[model samples]
Target: MIKIYSITVTTILLAVVSLISCSSEETSEKKQENLSTSPATANYAITPVDLRYVKLTDDFWLPVVKRVQEETIPYAIKKCEEEGRLHNFLIASGEMEGSVKGKMPFDDTDVYKIIEGASMTLISAPNPELEKELDRIITIIGKGQEDDGYLTTWRTINPKKPPAPWVNVVEGKRWESLTASHELYNAGHLYEAAYAHYKATGKTNFLNIAYKNADLIVKTFGDNEGQIAAVPGHQIIETGLIKLYALSGKEEYLKMARYFLDNRGRSEHHKLNDSYLSAAYSQDHLPVIEQDEVLGHAVRAMYMYAAMTDIAVLMKDADYENAVDKLWQNMVEKKIYLTGGLGARHEGEAFGDNYEL
Candidate 1:
């Protein structure tokens, strides 16, 4: 009887050990499965930048590009042709605040925005036949391109090159500022469109056009003599320039982008107390990171921060990434409304407060 009881105890111990070993093996397999699916674990499926860029380009940006291309840009051009104003660049319509004026006798800058927007359309919705139409549109936008590679309707129409004065100094005035002006804005958009075009269809023409545009920008502006210190009202140029750099594998473009980004934070223009204050207001204050909340000019802030994050993530800068992370977190988690509305009130075109969503 004692031997039988001992044998039973030994059998139970052996079975328990075997059961534990099996459980351990299963747990290891499960971990492997989990790692495979982990979004942040970085498999070949996608990266954060890719998703973010797509979200911005596909969902948010594509519609606006389509609307402007089909609706706004052509309408503006037709109006110009009808008014015999086709030679001059069309000032953007709707209420653009009293202070945000144009180069007048107009410039060709915005047509690229429309063109780039249209290019993005082809990217999001690839229609091979549509490429021909896009090519036509590009030609139209490029119609004003100068022999020296300069692309601006204002210069074509209003030759003083009537320096872009309002950039980076005022709230409502930034759009009129050079660097912060429409021309660079157009370049930025074109660069983005070029990137989308390449991503969507593996073509290089779109990227080439934008690259030439950047080269023109680099030649025209900078610390060089006769060049002003101001930048564009929008922030996309920095990222756009960076993209162009990567596209071409040229270091100059990256330097240009870095220069623009660094300039924004150095606190020079804002302290000038110059007429550009309105333009600076247009850019929504300096010290990009110190901006505790996402405030006025919803669209502008979104682009600026998004590009900033792209640069940060690509470069692996911890401080920049942390700031971007905080801002993005705030925008998505605390401030976004249920309808996908961002800013609660469009009055200032700014955000109200967190949780007000």
Candidate 2:
């Protein structure tokens, strides 16, 4: 069974404060002085302390992280194998003779997330066995990639037949249905996992896959002639690209991420999808900088907001910062649940109108 770690808000806040404090003896004092002068006008962003530097020893949170590292991680990996998540990779790579085996177009992300979680676990607790297993899994995943670096296994196995009926694939080609295809979403998770793996083991095996796929994405989408003008139906890719940019110092990756955000809600660039994939469903109803209220799938909205915050801090854009602030206030005051839960409407797994309970 999957074990959920129910971390309290106070515990999380304290952990964060402790981590920030550990950054430097004067970090907390400097932050306070900055807040006292101009609470929102800090010229620099806080640099996150690496997990290697911060050890979790408190009775409250250490157990939770241990549970994740010990029980949950192993359980998730076993479930993924049993559910054919691993086999899908081999099948796509032609190492196994079978069709895609999953219920979701984005099922590839299950493996990616597992790798990412395991990598994080390794950071705090070094395990040679786990590192070896990750290397094995990364190898299988790499085999599934197309020569050009596309790595969506289900699509690679059989683009004509999407794993789910809801995915609308008219052409049976890559990027045919950006809204439901989840191609970019898969890449996003892969990038995230790859980066984590790289950090944990100081390895480039998975990181190279991420970079190749990212390069393909950068070449595929843009305002340039012959390039497709579109945004992801779901979010997360923006943040993934931003992470890549931070690692590689690649301005193109950063530009690609900003382009995706800038083009959202601009109907002139591309028509939004219908039904659950509609503009509002993915927080594409308005440009990132102009979106004041939080709307859309709760997960999507949060990821978009995170990427927007990255943009605000990295680019020092006041407008983006303002929109994020406004949206946070709206969510806290009117949309968020009393228990801090989100997504009031289950049908779309989305946030409700203001004051909805």
TM-score of each: 0.62, 0.87
**Candidate 1 segments exceeding 4 Å error:** 1-110, 117-128, 159-176, 201-203, 220-227, 269-284, 353-357
TM-score, predicted candidate 2 vs. hidden true structure: 0.87
lDDT of 2 by residue, 92-179 (tens): 8899999888799999999999998788666556778888988998998999888999889988899999998888868798887788
Q: On residues 323-344, what C-alpha lDDT tens digit does candidate 1 reach at each position?
A: 6666767777888877767877
Among all candidates shown, the one with the greatest lDDT: 2
For every model shown, the clashing-pair count is: 29, 0
In model 1, what is the error at residue 333, expressed in angstroms? Answer: 4.4
- How many clashing pairs in candidate 2? 0
lDDT of 2 at 106: 92
